[model samples]
Target: MQTQRNRRGYIQHFINCKHLWLNELKKLAHDLKNPYLLKENVPEYPRPEFHVSHLKHDTERGALCWIRTDGGFKDPHRGFRDPHKWSLVWWSLAVGPEEIKAAETRLLEKTYPNQTKEQAVKQQSFLWRFATSPAFSEKSRYGSYRFTFPLQDVLSAYSQQFCFGAPPIMRVFRTCLFKKKVQYSVLVHSPANRELFSEFPLLPGNDPNAVCAYRDGRFIWRSEAMCETHRY
Candidate 1:
């Protein structure tokens, strides 16, 4: 059995990163090498239970908010049925209200090439239904970002070059979040390389303001930070 202090420490660490704690627990289990002992001394914490409650509330509120704004069915199961749906919703939220309107306009023009302005507006509004639908906000069983490249050439170029020797490319969707007073990204990865990509420094250590590269597969998404010339 873990000591009380040890249990508290483990719980605190686990709160920071559940996967890391679980990994450490697995390692400990293997080192002990005794199933009977492992069963008797398993670490217990209330965080996972609390986390579920927090997640459920967030999911419900997010879903309801989307439904009220979009005039769509309020199906909570849709988020559960499709994992990408939640991320997409999160992504949509990340893009400020103005961007969403502009994106809708752009999509309408592209999707309805020959339609008149009035017809296209009607069609586009209908098309926007998918974007604001509960069907697209489903929480995924496997939590990660999903990327769908619209252009085949963009997909092909990245696949051949960047995906080699790297992890499986699951999904890639873009969103803006505030980090250090500027909008930073929170990306999900399939073959998640959290350590490798976490602090991807774009330039040498000397430059405080440098554009960073967030990489997955063959593509590198650049941050908005301006790159500084190297001062040798």
Candidate 2:
């Protein structure tokens, strides 16, 4: 009886923490203050905007990184293709207050992997996910999963260019995914700094062989190879 009661207590505590984390996450996402320059380039569709938060200044123990996105089926266009089968991805960075604190330490370890001189110095994992439940199981229908690291990881590469004076503003990288002879499109999220991305190739506008599209969207890529790696 005592063990059963302890188990019930633990589960309740987990549920409470989850609720608190999610509430804080939503507040951070909707509190947009700056003008998002990249939103104007994309085709206006009702897609969920992804968010990240860091209470690095806070003394609180349960600070977290929250992500809102869709999982499986390759990309966002797949979700649009089958709205009824779309799955929402949501999860806290850590399971409990103790783990939440450890998560920050893990972030440091992830960012600077050369800390331990004994091990092979290399880039640690990026674009990784962790979940409190078995939602990502092979046969499961649930699709909630959260990226384990903060949004800073995504902005780190263009840190010098995009984040020198102010917090980097994320923009969309319009992408064309060609898989199984069917072409689909979705916005690739990135910092809005044009200098870093302007030189790279973009998906052609109207004409696949257009020499240079002047009024066309800024940064684009026909991700044919990328599409082969995942299901459409």
Indicate which candidate wins on lDDT: 1
- Provide TM-scores for the models: 0.21, 0.19
lDDT of each residue in 26-112, candidate 2, tens digit only: 343333221221123333211111112311111112212211222211223334433233321222221233332344345556665
- Evaluated against the true structure, the overall lDDT of model 1 is 0.31
- What overall lDDT goes with each candidate model? 0.31, 0.27
Worst 10 residues of 2 by lDDT: 11-20
- The sequence of per-residue lDDT tens digits that candidate 1 reaches over residues 62-114 is 55566569653334454444323432223211222333345456545665677
Candidate 1 TM-score over all chains jointly: 0.21
Question: Whole-model lDDT for model 2 versus the true structure?
Answer: 0.27
For all predictions, the C-alpha RMSD in Å is 22.3, 22.4
